[model samples]
Target: MPRIPFVIPLLLSLLGLAACSPPPTLDQQLYIWQRQWRPAHVEALAQTRLDFSTLRVLALQAHPKAGWARAYPDLQLLKRDGRPLVAVVRLDGQLPQLDPRAIGEQITSLLHDWQAAGIQLAGLEIDHDCATARLPAYAALLQDLRRQLPAELKLSITALPAWLASDQLEPLLASVDSSVLQVHAVSDPRRGLFDAEQAQHWAAEYAARSPSPFLLALPAYGVALLDSPAGAPRVEGEAPLRQGGTRRELQADPQHVASLLAELRDDPPPGLSGIIWFRLPLAGDRRAWPIDTLLAVVRGQPLRPALDLHAQQNGQLSELQLVNRGNLASALPAHIELPAQGCTAADGLGAYRVTSTPQGLRFTRQHPGQLAAGSQRALGWARCTQIDQGGLHVEL
Candidate 1:
């Protein structure tokens, strides 16, 4: 009979729960790195029709021990026209002699120079993989840049997963506008670069911890791992295919990334800005996915292999061509069924295993090979005693 004083408090609590809002969704963007720009790269990107709203470009990097920095100078190679750009200056090597004042001045100068050149600077991103012990120095450098940069411009940093657990992380994030959690490259490649389960766990943990909006940077490029006869892997190289020694290339499957995207979309992190790809795909880069495939995955679309079959005949000689028209790589068929028999191989298709199938001759690669997107490979030419003039009817 105390006038039911707790009733109003209970009703207010329910109201607060009802009025709470869900976390906001993050925008998806692409990173243009790990490839030299060419006409094909430009054309491939154009064909995809992806809305690359922001292009994060690697512009400059600080020299070790010296306060001076070097500009990429050939920024034109990026071909990042008609998009807001985020100029990233990477700090590499030891920073024992790092001078915050000198480094800040260099960065501020670079920003002003790019601005004068009519480049739209959405923000300046500092990519420094600083150690836990170096947090104070990193924080000081960021604070100085914050004071020096124009108020209209923003500041960001590329953060390591290990750094997320550091006590200095919160204070560091406070000094900048945003940060990028590079979820990939957490470990050595031979051990594997990305772990989907680990990524999801980190996302949930970091979302609850980060105070400012940040991005989840996923891997888009691949590395070629070469192993010796002794079974030791050599993980460093710039070329696509390494000669001498067993070489195996590793790339992230777009479909897998799509699954991760779906999980995040259902419930994204509280402070997440969006997802950013580590590198954009190039038309000539066989190790990377086609732009269309990457775009599809990002948009949560289904991916499947698309092959175009073509038949050609010249007199008694006939040819069969299988073209990969889709944006994802696929395995070659184990055998091709010919509508009629009495056909023999006229031209050997390099190294292959030719075996007899009930329907026709089965063709399998002696060595493992994949059909790359947008590429045409010869299935082999055959001389038919009785050829279908219209063309050889075949099944893949």
Candidate 2:
């Protein structure tokens, strides 16, 4: 008996199943760009261990004037967990020319030194913001560097979206094992730091152009643009520069980024491997997102801001505090009212204005402020004969 009919139905069913199957999970990595590693990195690394599979650390940076500066990262901290690590070497875009052999030699020497220090490196990444016209030369540099590197170690490059228009893009990509397409802060600073729509478009375009596997470098942090009289605004990230003209702060919204991530996960571009966050946020890093907030977004968990008011009483004195208990950071409430009677003294702290009313004490916000997740802020203190915690009112 002929079995063609049965085989056709079976093949159709298999195709249907394949079509409905979920896309592959995108791996998440992090860039530890901090040149100086501190004790706080210990906690930061531990917190992100489950989410980030690899670490792309800044090992060395070449400056136009200062020449070359090596990062003093804590080797013990990075090697403790045995995670796959990639050493990144940055070449300033302002440089006039690059000696391919000299640069390659320096990188090779750096790799040897790191290996001697017992640091296991999985790959090497060259971060050079070369102009589109100079891509051919950039490719030559990468090719030379690749030859100098050990055959076992993978070589990658941080690619720019502007290079898409150049005919040399394909060859530039071909010179490396992988590429990291940076989608944040690639546009005019006056416009903003990140545009989700534009980023998605770039990612799709990059996937079409890149033959090798690639990752999207999304921003998990923010920057302050200090106005300069001379030219472009000076960007301040991680630390503040010398005081300048009016300042504007730009931050990447977690909700927007999470939505984008969900869209990509549902239907990822071809050859798109994963995401490498621009930075791993530390406790002291003010411009970056809170660790909890970043983790929640990466895990696709719901983001909810929870603010709680606490009044610690010692005799007649009460210390008022506001605590953010949820995974999302929240703005400080605009008004806080505490019903009280026979209050001898009451005062507001920080950006709040205190008003002692006949019925209670009212604290009105004088300025805007954000309370980070798992952080608490002191509001004010009050001394009253009768105060009701149940009647505490807050207006956000």
Candidate 3:
């Protein structure tokens, strides 16, 4: 018998053409991320003792370029602990990065829908291959979005560490959520370049005057700088971007992540928020979102972070974490306990969502049939939109 290979889809990007359609509602965008994870279980963070309210905004990275958003659905998925916050809109090659006005309009629409849904939409995450000279255009686009958004929504962007004078871009970030310094691609610091540490220090200094929360994006996707085409990252070069590397050559791991997380965690920076990973199901990476390892590091937050969450008008991400660790074979009709909030019940993870009403939360299954053992599921798709959160008792 011949060996079989996994089929990977090569997608055509929507970027450079960001806003071909009218803006989508916040509820709609929420559906997009929902499809990413399935057959897995999510549990309340009653153990970490970490508080979502204490942290800043939560966000998720999406590659609109990878064709992820076409189906983003609506759901109040994020377990929002508190308000005066916004989730990130990591713009992963989704739009054509060329048209400034189009970008502005797209972002404005996002802000508007979040507001309509009663969400405190802080702002967006602009990810791009930075061209130092284009800072002016970037700032201009941000300003445009700011002007269009209802003054309340802020903008957050990801930048390579090397752009020496990040200080120069301070004014732009000041208008939005703190800018996250992307030090992952910056593999070398020797040739007038900057890496994560240097970027962190620089961002810290820049934040002094503006004083907004800051975030550092670590690599969930490993890379080796193309120092000699042996899989090297080009933090600030015209060479094509190098995405995956052998796990050994790669920089992403629990230990490496902890190191980065520790640095950001230790910082006494006033508005410093936590770190955000690149994307879910990161292409070519061993893992997508390391919910278990991350939960092990920081647990127990009442509300899910904006970065870790995605929601629609009715659905929000409470938290997609690991309660049983690697127990994939766990049976369906698994018991879920939102104990800290006094909401305990058994609901199939196969359900799309759990809705909260005056009477309490409601858990409805997405599919008609019962979920099998070790299955993965998420709340939010139109078909699977089920409520599994309200306190209750059930039999699989």
Q: Candidate 2, after superposition: displacement of residue 47 in Å?
A: 0.6
Worst 10 residues of 2 by lDDT: 238-247
Tell me how far the alpha carbon of residue 255 in candidate 1 is from the true structure, in angstroms, after superposition: 2.2
TM-scores of the models, in the order given: 0.81, 0.96, 0.47
Residue 151, model 2: lDDT of 92
Point out the higher-scoring one by TM-score: 2 or 3: 2
Clashes of each: 0, 0, 63
Error of 1 at 227 (Å): 4.4
lDDT for model 2, on a 0 to 1 scale?
A: 0.90
- Local lDDT at 78 for model 3: 36
1 or 3: which has the higher TM-score? Answer: 1
lDDT tens digits, residue span 1-396, model 3? 965444322122354345354332111011012334332312322321242332223234335456324223232433343323445555553344656565555556655565676665545556665566666666777776667666544566766655555555665666566667566545442333224455557657644644476665554333334443544434322123545532222334444445545565545355555555443321222323334444433332221211111223234224332222231112333333221233333232444345544444444544442221122345322222342433334333
- Model 2 CA deviation exceeding 4 Å by range: 1-4
Off by over 4 Å in 1: 1-25, 34-36, 62-80, 93-97, 227-244, 312-316, 340-345, 355-360, 385-396
Q: How close is each model in CA RMSD to the real structure?
A: 5.0, 1.7, 22.6
